[model samples]
Target chain A: MKAATTSETAEREARRNRIRLMQGNEACAEGALAAGCRFFAGYPITPSSEIGEYLALHLPRVGGNFIQMEDEIASMAAIIGASLAGVKSMTATSGPGFSLKQENLGFACIAEIPCVVVNVMRGGPSTGLPTGPSQGDFMQARWGTHGDHPIVVLAPYSVREVFTETIRAFNLSESFRTPVILLMDEVLAHMREKVILPEPAECPAVDRLRPTGPPEAYLPYASDRDVSPLAPFGSGYRFHVTGLYHDETGFPTGSPAKIRQQMERLMGKMERGAGQIQRFELTGAVSGGSDPVDTLVVAYGSTARAAKHAVGEARQSKRSVALFRPVTLWPFPEAAIRQVSGSVRRVVVPEMSLGQLAGEVQKCIPPKAELRRVNRVDGIPIAPEEILDAIVA
Target chain B: MANRIEVRFSGSGGQGIILSGVILAEAAAIYDNKNAVQSQSYGPEARGGASKAEVIISDGDIDYPKATNIDILLALTQVACDKYTPDLKEGGVLIVDSQEVLAIPEGNFRAYSIPIFRLAQEKVGKRIVANIIALGALVGLTGVVSRKALEEAVLSRVPRGTEDLNLTALRAGFEEAERLQRAEA
Candidate 1:
């Protein structure tokens, strides 16, 4: 018994040493494993393919299922099917594949299914640059699916953030009963960094909200605590779910009154719970406890890392500059941005796309506040020096 | 901050330039407690097309992970050198494998012509270990990293039994650097 106990302790220590240099996509796969994701279905696409490869190699070892579907459409459908069967499912793709998955994504939205989809963004329009980084998918993630539906999307700037936001994506999807997107660019997806992974004991796992009462009384779409609980298929709550408008019993309904109520409830949970889902980080914005003199740089994803560096350089030259990075892209941080408007004179928005987030910032900031955009759509990150020059000039 | 060295590895695909940058970044970040970031390009055509990896090491917090100006340039192909040479700061170091890179541009920066292929053939008897050989020579020339730390990093990175072969390649690179230093002195 003593020998067996000692061996167990040694095995635990060995597991702890799993910390090694890993690419961002690989770390994301490891994060999904820790998030209790049992089902991953994806198609092979540049940049985002590494995430699929990692899952294919490691998922079975941990008793999870990894499937490579025929294409993005089938991949997304399988994830939704797996999630409804009481499994935490996820799918990842790039710009072209993300475009193909939009129809199924709309299906998930209308069905109010819980799953996570990762878009490791690359240059776009149509397969522009498969390996290069781009943030052209910002507007697409928010408004890609048809109809008026609310969604949650998170952007991770570093490899470490990729790991954490993936877990958050699963948590939010399960809690809200909606498909959550974890948006990453090719730079963060391909770059290798030293990620300090959390110990198993430190990570919190969120399982699907199961029904508690008798199976006969269970209603899959019935509201409770502002969010409805999901009933597994074999659990006897054999309610029909469809892409068409549904009622409280999960059956298709054509009544305008029922349709209006269902849509409101579906959108209300994410809209009302925006405060809890939003996350951002600020640097150099509150220096010397006074109004920021001239420029405030707003960037996200890999571009935010460059913005932080530019802000630091500008400060060294006695220039008053700051950076505002949105960790959560959707449910746009209007309140936090309004706060920034009160303190800054000018806002400079730099992105890998041509003013996608800049347009969002313009809507949020005060009208009188000057808005300058440093836009690049060439599948490369905006350099730090470029932003610093803009700040200094 | 003043003593930190940032090196960039650039070459055509199949040259293992990304792995070389990774080894250096791991040596600096994990073994030396220095802040390091490694970025590379990936694509379907990366096997024979242009490929590059950039490593930035600093004593202070590295806010910008991308390298704008390189301190050392390891160009394995002419196209790689032509693309990146303009980005090297003045008086920077350039190391080229003699067999692959035929022309060395005249500049104030120090240039070393190491027989990386020949050394790989002689020591490890494999062209794939050419990156390990170049990395060894890089350690010898810069002395920014200690041999022991690099050896430990190499041992930890390679396959289970190939640790000794990599270590030998690293030592051969160190000797090549020492010999060059002695010749220059």
Candidate 2:
């Protein structure tokens, strides 16, 4: 009886901690905490400002620091600095702010710093819709910063997924020693839903691997393992880090040999780990374990939810359709699409932006496979019925 | 199984519509052992915008928390009345604070044009408690939630010193509901 009572009490406490009605931004903050993020720096931008506000209120309570930086550039810079100091750090911004942070984001990539940047996307070329939704930043998130570099980006559709993916973003960042972008659209940012927050013990926490042996023996960039160990400042391991090409000892090396080596390692880590980082969900890919789906719907972010609904509606009308939702938008899930392309006869890409993910889908699928694009950019989510019409047509 | 009630509150941004829905949901979920969901919608501009909150209370789990048809529609403004009146289920109740919401629709649904603002002014000496008055009328008309449960929920939610005033406002609403019921009978 005592054992049963104790177990029941534990279960009740767990349920109490879990059930919550949380906004998307609040879920992102909670996810950051669950992922063991200890530092957050950000500037206030509409739709994304609540993330900073939430972190400011909640971070300190959990022994984490939240700083409101002067601008997005400084905010991104501060998070990179915090990451180098051996703390998981993150920053949240919208389009204009994301544009400002791009240079530093590239710097983090070149320097191989593990950090997460959340872009709660709003409508924009420049301040398009401060409060409305837009998925226009899909290409920007991939190639926003100048130069050739690989990135890992994830888009979440719901509040609960926001919590889970923000945690995944931090894990991927640390594991790969690069920045991960949590690309959230404005619809997901402001949407409120019931989310069950995981208990402190239930969350998986990843700390950056630390250097062992004497400080004198440490070579900051020297690594046989795919992931190099990160040495925090003030640990008596003196090392130099710069945006310029560098040697193994961390000194500036302009030599072509050193530059080639550094670039390969930067690119290779993501390439090598691409299999692990690529995430997609395929619904209704097969029927009766033999017949393949003739119609395919490709979507990401907020549009994916509506696309899923469309796929359901299409299936009821005797149309064999399936949905491909890209959970991880970057290190673009090319392999998954290639696999899906083999079976499906026609592909439909619906997005809030003008054919961003559609371009990527076309790149992966064969030319013979019919590809269609359904794009909307009026700051409203694409209705399922519209996609259903496209599939049937 | 006990009867379930879903209420939707609509008003301008600063009118405490979300807070009223939250209080009602908490009353049902925390106090009455019912499953409840509260959802609110507001545009990007936080102020001077149409805002709404939907509260769903059920003995079982609520599958779709979004109100397809509302049981009670509390419209604090003319725009809200025009926008939400059609969404109220047939025979559902409509409560409007007559001072802020000047217009009303004639319909089959039980429409209560409560002098919520005047009652709030007379009892609490402030118009802000008009929502509280409407909430009281809702409780009296439906009896979906017990008075004690709502009173306790309000006390826990409001700030320390303001509990007494809110309680008084709630009791006044309950009294008004009793008077209306007596008159009808």
Candidate 3:
């Protein structure tokens, strides 16, 4: 992949391969741009607003389009429109805004529109803490929207991972022809750190499967080939797209047979890409040994940082502890979590939310293992000391 | 984590203390090639509200990005000085504005009384650049980031046409802190 040396892309290329200390929100915007996204529509919300600010300032320079819609609903609708027009599009919002976008989120999923929606999570059941961090949206990202349709939610731990994970989000969204939620908490969104960004040549980019035939031969919702090829609207592919359960031809069909097939297809696309989407980092308890550690720690996002540090601290005191970090939240890597579960006598799951991820981990915990929870809901992140205390206790 | 140094800047919002924290983290992470994380507490109001920013610089990865045991605290106002003093580690350095601060709390930490705001207003001709002056003084006392790297970080973030005044403020800060250290020695 060569730089788009044209005047439009010169500004974008100038930013690549630089060592800049950047906030996670800013890096995510740059990452989206690098992944070939050319359209953005977002509403301003604290913590995640920097992403909109950065994109609004720089998107025009790179020949991209940006619109601040009236609210999150319109913002989500606008990105789906842009994506259906054959342009890569995205939107960023915090919890309240994310809640507003839920209906449209389901629309994009059933319609097979390739778009990215970024939810920088804050403490919330309802605008709970606008400027503080929380992982309370863990289940919301998966089950918030109305249907049984599949979702791809990717979480990042650091400034650099936010960049790379965003690129992966876009690629997976386009590759799977679905809406991918790039989940971030307030801590990851607002915290600034150094990142060694990849050169534009190395950053991966993927385009949606396009139709190879004339408009007459196109099937907008066909899933015979895994992810159906999405023909750009107005590109002569006159296909119906709707929120209702649809048939293979992209037209709504209420018949039970067609509905079953369409629903299965929506679920099957992610199932096919599960291996590619699932990622986990596993470390032994004793640092240098492959011995079956008696205890294991499981975490994700910002809490993973605390869990990791606590694992190291626990090991320093000769308390055997291992760490399992799932970078992908949805399609929860149950297999990996279960692999380490049967052997460890105890498993600890610490989360900023009361017990969302911990509840999910309970399903995979080995029956013999005693499940421990180090839960916090005070709008502050779980510190290493808290997790370490749980480990030693 | 022992190799990490944690620093915090606290003052009212208009004092630009948050930007100083950003610059210090940038100087270490980018120019000095160390890992750093900068974060802040955003108050409801933009000015006169309590504003605090923290940066954790380390030679390796930093987990738990917020400050656990603050190594250095720069308090530009009495409210900040009083509120943040408890979080300071044992023997940590606490620098406060001598003119604005009337009392110094007795603690295990080393306390320094520097007229940073006065130095900016009187020497640099703008009290708004006091954060930069404090930044210069902090680096001089701690030797955390090199003088040149801090200067580059400060100049890059400061607005155009005012770079000279900010540079003057930073230098004045270095000289004043060095004088205090020499006198104490």
Candidate 4:
């Protein structure tokens, strides 16, 4: 009887971790919930509507709030407001909506508000392809907001990574006190795959650092520390918030020294913590093997999946090729790229855009290395065969 | 079973083609202890536009999610059959709805033209469950996933009160597939 009971308990425990057939958008919502996101505000858009729809039905059940704002700008503003009120907040949108959120996104940056933004990329300059996939926003995510600001953008390749990357987006946002963008392409947003998610206990949630000093003595934008603690609005601690360049006291300042200090501290936080924020994966280059790969394939998002298949095919044909995929797209993983590309003379980058990511990779590799690009802008994904041809050619 | 099989279900948008692919992927990944990835391409129309959903099931990891060399092609309309027949591998399995896809294209593959929609309407008393019926025949024809797992996935996805109706439609397709198998033998 005792043995049977123990076996039954084990079976139930295993069942609790059952594999789920999850879509990428669905996994993002689950990740937000796991990261303790208690507020979501967004306008529904193509390739990203499911994330909003899922949260609309499930957020209230978990005692979280979900609001459908009138427009993308308001959606971004609402999340900023929620974050100021001591809640972990997020907003999800696609290409066009991402464009509309740029103004508020910059506001969040200048204000140093902690929030999450999910950009499910699709073909675009204006509302190009609603259901199609594209990575055209690769550079836009970094520089779209107009000024010099520190931002973190994470691009997940598969459904499993979508879950983990979304959680990491929240964690990095809170840790840096800056808005983080979870970049996902159309294919990654809509594709479904089997994922056994990590349990809550396994992936501990992270909250923003709180001010320990007296409420009256708090400085919202203190430059002395690497990251100044942010106290929620309406709390005992009162502080001013604005879009202008501010001093350590959280009020606007015209003094050049104060402006320089604030800007330096804002950019320095990321510079010192780049090691903890940047993530990349390297494969096909054996550590101890003598055959150094002469070709390096750089990719991210869904395109990386095709690149991975092509890399495996090349290896089977006795070709020396390696793959470098960046899980964190921003603060660009330059150090890892330089280290891996030192031995290779050829670097191939395949993306849905003409050459967004290729442009960035060009600045990092050896000056003598040849950069080859395989681009697809016809609203169709780059196939594995195309990548294989690039690898061998 | 082969190391990997790529299956594509092509039909009109409202015909539940994507949902059929989703159920098959869930059955294989959740119950059979395999890796499965499902993806789709659809136009902006909510209904009537040509839509295709593809599933890749493998014993190992699935790198590329889209189906290139299709092992199984299930077309519910003539337009879909004409469009996707060229993607099928030689000696691949092609299943189409006989009533809807009247002019079947020539292909280097095994073809099974079943009265899928008609059977759902006549035997199951509902035309909306044709996707479920088609799923049963596809599984019965290939044995790609276990029947128990298929039933479980179907029940979990369908509406609460419609389990009995959907099961009856599924069993009808299975019976028809069995008859075809016996005739070939």
Best by lDDT: 4
Taking the candidates in order, what DockQ does each have?
A: 0.63, 0.23, 0.79, 0.94
Q: Give DockQ: model 3.
A: 0.79
Question: Which candidate model has the greater lDDT, 3 or 4?
Answer: 4
lDDT of 1 by residue, B53-159 (tens): 88887777666678787789988887777777788888998988888888887776888988988999998888888888888899889865677777777887888
- lDDT ranking, best first: 4, 3, 1, 2
Q: In model 4, which runs have C-alpha deviations exceeding 4 angstroms?
A: A1-16, A286-289
Rank ordering of all candidates by DockQ, starting from the highest: 4, 3, 1, 2
* lDDT at position B110, candidate 4: 89
What tens-digit string does per-residue lDDT give for candidate 3 at A1-393? 354457547765555337788899998999999998899999999879999999999899999988998999999999999999999999999999999999999999889899999999988888888878889999999988986988999999999999999999999999999899999998888889888787777876989888988788888877576787898888888888888887888777889988887788789888878999987788665323576778889998888988998998888888788999999998889887877776778889999888899898989977888888998877778999988888888
Q: What is residue A145's positional error in candidate 4, in angstroms?
A: 0.4
| Candidate 1 runs further than 4 Å off | A1-19, A223-225, A287-293, B1-4
**Model 1, A104: alpha-carbon shift in Å?**
1.1
Which candidate number maximizes DockQ?
A: 4
lDDT tens digits, residue span A307-375, model 4: 999999999988999999999999999988987888787999999999999999998899898899999
Q: Which stretches of candidate 2 lie over 4 Å from their true place?
A: A316-318, A366-372, B1-8, B21-46, B53-73, B84-95, B105-112, B135-156, B167-185
Question: Candidate 4 DockQ category?
Answer: high
- Tell me the docking grade of candidate 2: incorrect
* lDDT (Cα, tens digit) per residue for candidate 1, span A214-325: 7777777774555777988887767788988888888888999888888888888887999889999988855346645467788999999899988987888788787889
The alpha-carbon lDDT assigned to residue A212 of candidate 3 equals 86
The global C-alpha lDDT for each of the candidates, from Candidate 1 onward, is 0.85, 0.84, 0.88, 0.92
Task: Say which prediction, candidate 2 or candidate 4, comes out ahead on lDDT.
Answer: 4
Clashing pairs in 3: none
